[model samples]
Target: MKRIAVVGASLAGVRAAQELRAQGYDGGIVLIGSEAHLPYDRPPLSKAFLAGTVSAASLELLDAGDLASLALDFRLGVRATAVEPAARRVLLSDGGSVHADGVVIATGGRARTVPGWSGVHTLRTVDDALALRAALVPGVRVVVIGAGFIGAEVASTCRSLGLDVTVLEALDAPMAPVLGPALAAVCARLHLDHGTDLRCGVSVTAVGPAGVHLADGSLVPADVVVAGIGMTPATEWLAGSGLTVSVGVCVDTGLVTSLPNVVAVGDVARYGGRRHEHWTNASEQAPVAVANLLAGRTSRTYSPSGYVWSDQYSGRLQLAGHPSPADTFSVVDGELSSSSFAAVWQRNGETVGVFALNNAKLFNRLRRPLRRPAVV
Candidate 1:
C-alpha cells in the first residue's frame, strides 16, 4: 500500500498508524478525526478527570514529540461523509476526498441518549467530561441514569465531591447483563456503602428540568442529570455503503469488511456477532487489522479473552475472559465481605474466566490460564 487513510484518530486509529510505521510501511498516512483535539484516553474521563485529580492535557495519547516522529497528516475536527469502495476514496464532510490504497474505519461510538431529555447530560469525550464536571459541585442534587460502568464511576466521583448522588437502573442489580445478578448485587453494595442512593428495578418515565419521573409516579429531585445508559456505534455515516452493519460495522475474523482493502476496528467493528467495547480489545485488534491490510489475506484472526476493570470507592474490580451466565463461580482467594478477593468462573468443570476485587496480583495470574483450551 502506497497511501493509507485511518478514520476516527482515537486510540485504535493512532495505534494502527503506529503499527503500520513500525512494520516498515513508509507510506503516506492520513489520520482523520471528528473531534477537534488530539486523541485522548476515554477511560479516565469518568474517573480521575471528572474528579479533578487529572488534567485535560494528561489524556492525550500522542504528545508533540510523538506526533512529530510519526509524520502523520493529522486532520482534526472533520467527519467522514461516506466511503466509495469502487473509487477507493473517502468522502469528507468538507467536500474533500482522500484517495488511498487502504482505509481503516475506527470511528468508535457515541453515548446513547434519552429522547426529549435536553436537561440531561452524557459523557463520551473529554469535552463532555469537562462540562459535566463543572456542574458537579458540592450540595448539588445529582441523579445519574443507568448503573453501568460510566454511571457507577460518575456516582463515585459525585459522592467524593459531597453531592447528593442517586443512581437509577431498570434491571434488578447493577451491571447484571455482564456480571449476572448475584455478582451485580454484590457490586451494587459498593455504591450503597459510599452513601449513594441506588435504586434498582425501577423505570424512568421521563426526565425534565425538575427531576427524573419514575413509572410509579415518584420523582427523584435533581439539580443535574447524567445519563450513562450505553453507547451506539458511529455508523450512520456508513449508510448505503454496501457493508453489512447491524449494531456496528460487521467484520470477518480478520476485521475486514465487505469492501476491499478496508477494515474496521475498536468499538465500531463487530466481529463474530459481538462487540467488545473495552480498551484491551481495541489495542489488540489494531495490530491484527494492520497485518491483514499489508498481507492481503487473513494472516491474523482477532480473538479477545475479554478483560475489563472498574474503580469504585477504594476497590479495583477486574474481570478477565468470557464469563457467561451458565458458568460456575467460586471464591478462589480472599473474601467478598472484606472487599478484597478473587473468584474463578468455570464452564463444564473447566476454568473460563476470573473476577477480582482489589487483587491485581491474583487477577493477572489467572488471566493466562483462562486463555487455554477447556479440558474436557
Candidate 2:
C-alpha cells in the first residue's frame, strides 16, 4: 500500500497520479507510458499546432519540477507487456518489472493509419503535428482523407494558410453519425462556404505519387494528404491479461477489471457503467479510480457518461448526455444551418441526449444538472 504503478502515461495516467497525491497518499508513484514524451493534449495536434500557431512545448501535462515534487517516477518509452495480479507487478517489454500495491491502465488509443497513402499523414501526437505543420504553406495543394473532427480541423488549419484543400469523405455527410444526417449537412455547407472542396460519397481507389484516384476514375490532384479515421484503443498488450478486451479495455463503474487491483481509464477504457470515449469521462474516472485504489477498497462505483465537444471554424459543438436506444429527437431551437441551436434527444418523454451547435450559452446552461436514467 506504499507504492502504486499507473500505466498508459496519457491524460488518465497523469490525472490518476495527481489524484492519488491529492487524496493524501504519500507513496512512491510510477507512471508508465509507451510514448517517450510525457502526457500531452492530443486535440490541438490537428488544429492550432498544425496551423503553426501552437508549439509542442506548451502541450506537456506535467513539468519536470512538478514530477520532482510529486516524487513520481515516469517510465517513459516503456511498453507494458503483462499484468501479474498474483505478484502485484507489471511486466514491461523492456525487461523490467514495477511492483506496486495498485495499477491503473490509461494507455489511451492509436490513430488508424491508412494504407497505400504514403503521402498522407495522421495527426495523433506532437511529432505528427510538427510534421504536418511543416507542410502548411500558402498555396500548397492538400487533400484531407476524412471529415471527422481531426480532418475538419486539419482542413481548417490548411484553409488558414490559403492552401487549396479538398476533403474526401466516404460517408454521405460529415459528422452525421454523431450529429445526425441533417446537421452534418450544415457542416458540409460550412466547408464549401469556406472554399474547401468537400467531396463526399467518394472512395479513394488508389493513393500514389501522382494524386488520389477515385473509385469513379476521377483524379484529385494534391501534393499531400492527411487521414483522420479515428483510432483503436491501445490495449493489445493486455491480450493475454485475461480481462475483457473488445474494441477497448472493458471496465466497470469502480474502474476495476476482473483482475484484482487493476483499473483502466481514458479512451482505452470501456467502462461497463456507461461509454467513456470522452475527455469529460476521463476527467471524472481518473480521480474515482485513484480514490478506490488508495483506499484499498473494491466496491466503490463511478460511471462513465460519454461526452465530447468540437470547434469547426466559427461553430461550436457540444454533446451533453448519452443517447438512448429508442431516442427520438427534436430541434428545440434554431435551424441546422442557422445561428445558435440545440437538438434534444428524448427516450419515452425524458431527455437522454442534448447537443448544442453554435449555442455556447445554452450549452453552458444545460451542461450541469442533467442525468440519464438507466435504460432497461
Candidate 3:
C-alpha cells in the first residue's frame, strides 16, 4: 500500500499510524481528525483536566518533534463526510478527497444529549470539560445525571472542588447493568459514604434552566447540571456508504468492515456484535487493525481482553474479563468494609471475571488469570 488514510485522529487512529510505521510501512500516512486539536487523551478530560491539574498541551498524544519525525500528513479540523469504498477515497467536508489503498475508521463517539435541556451539559470533548469545570466552583449545586463511570467521576471531581453534588440514576443502583445489583449496591454505598446525595430508581421528566424535574413533580435545585447518561457512535457520515452500521460500524473478528479495503477500531467499531467503550480496548485493537490492513487475510484475529478501571474519591475500581448478569460473584480476598478487596465472578463453575477495589496490586496480578479461557 502506497498510502493509508486514517479517519479520526484520536488514540486508536494515532496508534494505528504508529504501528504502521513500526511495522515498516513507509507509505504516505494521512491522519484526519474532526477536532481542530491534534490527538489528545480523553480519559484525563474528566479528572486532571477538569480539576485544572493538567493543561490542554499535556493532553497531546504526539508532540511536534514526534509528529515531524513521523512525517504524517495531519489533517485537523476536517470531518470525513463520506467514504467511497469502490473508489478507495474519503470525502471530506471541505470539498476535498483523500485517496488511499486502505482506510481506518476510528471516529469514536460523542455523548448523548437530552432534548430541550438548555442549561444541562455533557462532557465528551476538551471544550466540554473546560466549560463544565468553569461552572463547578466551590459551593455550587451540581446535579450529575446517570451513575455510570463518567457520571461518578464528574461527581467526584465536583465534590473535590467543594461543590455540593447529587447523582440521579434510573436504575436501582449505580452500574447495575455491568456489576449486577449485589456488587452495584456496594458501589452505590461508596458514593453515599463520600457525601454524595444519590437518588436511585427515579426518573427525570425534564431539565430546564431552573433545575431537574422528577417524575414525582419534585425539582432538584441545581446551579449546574451534567449528563453522563451514555454515548452514541459517530457514524452519521457513513450513511449510504454500503457499510453495515448498527449501534456502530459492524466489523468482523479481524476488525474488517463489510466494505472493501476498510477497517474500523476504537469506540466506533462494533466487533463481535459489541462496542467496547474503554481506552484499553482501543489501544489493543489498533495493532490488530493495522496488521489486517497491511497483511490482508493473513492478519491476526482480534480477541478482547476485557478490562476497565474507574477513579473516585482516592479509590480505584478495576475489572477484568467479562461478567454477565447471571454470573455469580464471591469476595475472594479482603472485605468491602475495609475498602480494599478482590472479587471473582463465576459462571457454570468457571471463573469469568474478577473485580478489585483499592487493590491495584491484586488487580494486576489477577488480570492474566482472569483473561484465561478457563480459570479454576
Candidate 4:
C-alpha cells in the first residue's frame, strides 16, 4: 500500500491527514511529531488553558478515539532527519525510513528563545505554555519579554488570573510591524487598561537569571519571566533535503516543493506566491497538496492571502488580505474606546483587509468582497 509521511504533526499536518481521509485516501498515513503529546490547540494554550478556565485535557485537538478512528500511524516524539524526494522516502532520526508516495512537511515553527534570562520561559507548545502557566500564579510578579501575539495573549491570560504582569516590547509598539503604529498603539493601551504594565520601545539588551535586564540598565524583578520573543520554523532537519529551506521550506502556489512527491505546509512553509505563516492559510493550503498526493488530483492551486486575528481584551482583531505599509488606508469604523466595530484597510482603491474589534458582523460582511478582489 502507498504510504504518506507527514512530518511535523502540527495544525497543517493534522489537517492534511484529516482532509486526506475525508477525500477518501485511506492507504497508510503516518504522522511524525517531535512532541510526545498528541496535537492540541496552540491558540488556546495562551488563552483559556493558561487562564485555568479550560483544562489541558479539553485543549486536545484530537482525542484517542478520533485518532483510532482515523487509523493513522502516529510517530510521536520522532523527528525526521531528512527527506529523500528522489527516493520518495523520509529518513527518521531513529535510523528508520518511511517510504512515501508523497511527503508533507508541516513541522511548523519553534518559539525563538532569548539569551540570558535563562530562567525565562516561552509559550509555543503545550509543554511550553504549561510551564509558563505554572509561573503565572495569582499575585506573582510575572515579567513577560516581547509583546507579540503570544506575549500579549500570555499577558492577557495572566491578568485574567489576577496576577501582576509586566510586558516588555523591544519595538516601539506591540505588533508594531504587523498592525502599523496607529492600531498597534490602541493594542498597547488595551493591555494597559487590563492591568498589564506594558513597556514599549524598551529593549532587553540582556536578560538575567533574576529577571529581564533592560537596555536602560534597570532590572525588572519578577517571580518568573516568560519570553515570547518569536518563533522560527522547524526546518533544521530538512537541510540539504533538495528543498528550498530558507526562512521556511518554500513551496509553490500549489503548496508543492521543488522535489517530486514532496510538499510542505504550515508555519514551516513559505507557500503561495509569498510566505504566509498564518494557521488558517496553512489549513487552506494543505488540502491542495493532499488532493494532489492521494487521489492523483493535481489540478488545484493556492493563492496566499495572509489572514490572522487576535482576541485582545473584549475585541476581536481580524485581518483579511495583505495590506502593506504603502497600501491605502481607510477606517470603516474605529470605536475602539468601547471596544466594538471594524476598521477597513484599503490599498490601490481595493479593500485589502478589515480589522475588527468585537465586530464579527462587520468582519463577515467585509470578508467575501475583500477575498474576491478584482482589478478595476
Off by over 4 Å in 4: 272-274, 294-298, 372-376
TM-score preference between candidates 2 and 3, better one? 3
Error of 4 at 265 (Å): 0.7
**Global lDDT of model 1:** 0.88
Candidate 2 residue-wise lDDT, 255-292, digit = tens = 77776577877888786533456667777787777766
- Residue 224, candidate 2: how far off, in angstroms? 1.2
Q: What is the alpha-carbon RMSD of candidate 4 to the true structure?
A: 2.6
Residue-level lDDT of model 1, residues 1-376, one tens digit each, is 8889999988999989988888788999999899999899889998999999999899999988888878999888999989877787888888898887899999999999978886888999999999999998778899999999889989998888888999999999998888877678778989999999999999999999889999999999999999998899999888877888999999988898886588999999999898989987888788788888887777788778688898987779899889888889888998767688999889988889899999999899987876632111
Write down the lDDT of every candidate, Cα atoms only. 0.88, 0.79, 0.88, 0.78
Q: What is the lDDT of candidate 3?
A: 0.88
Q: Give lDDT tens digits, candidate 3, residues 307-355.
A: 9899987779898899887888888889866688998888888878988
Pick by lDDT: 1 or 4, better one: 1
Work out the TM-score per prediction: 0.97, 0.91, 0.96, 0.93
Predictions: Cα RMSD each:
2.2, 2.7, 2.3, 2.6
Q: For candidate 4, lDDT tens digit of each residue in 1-376?
A: 3788989877888898888888888789999998888887788888888877887788777887787878889889889998887787889888898898888889888888755457778788888877877777667898888888778888888877778889998888988687788788778888988889989888887666677778888988888888888788788888767788788888766677776577777888785444666778778876678766654444567655567877766656777777777876656765656577677777667788777777788888887666632111
Clash totals for all models, in order?
Answer: 0, 0, 0, 2
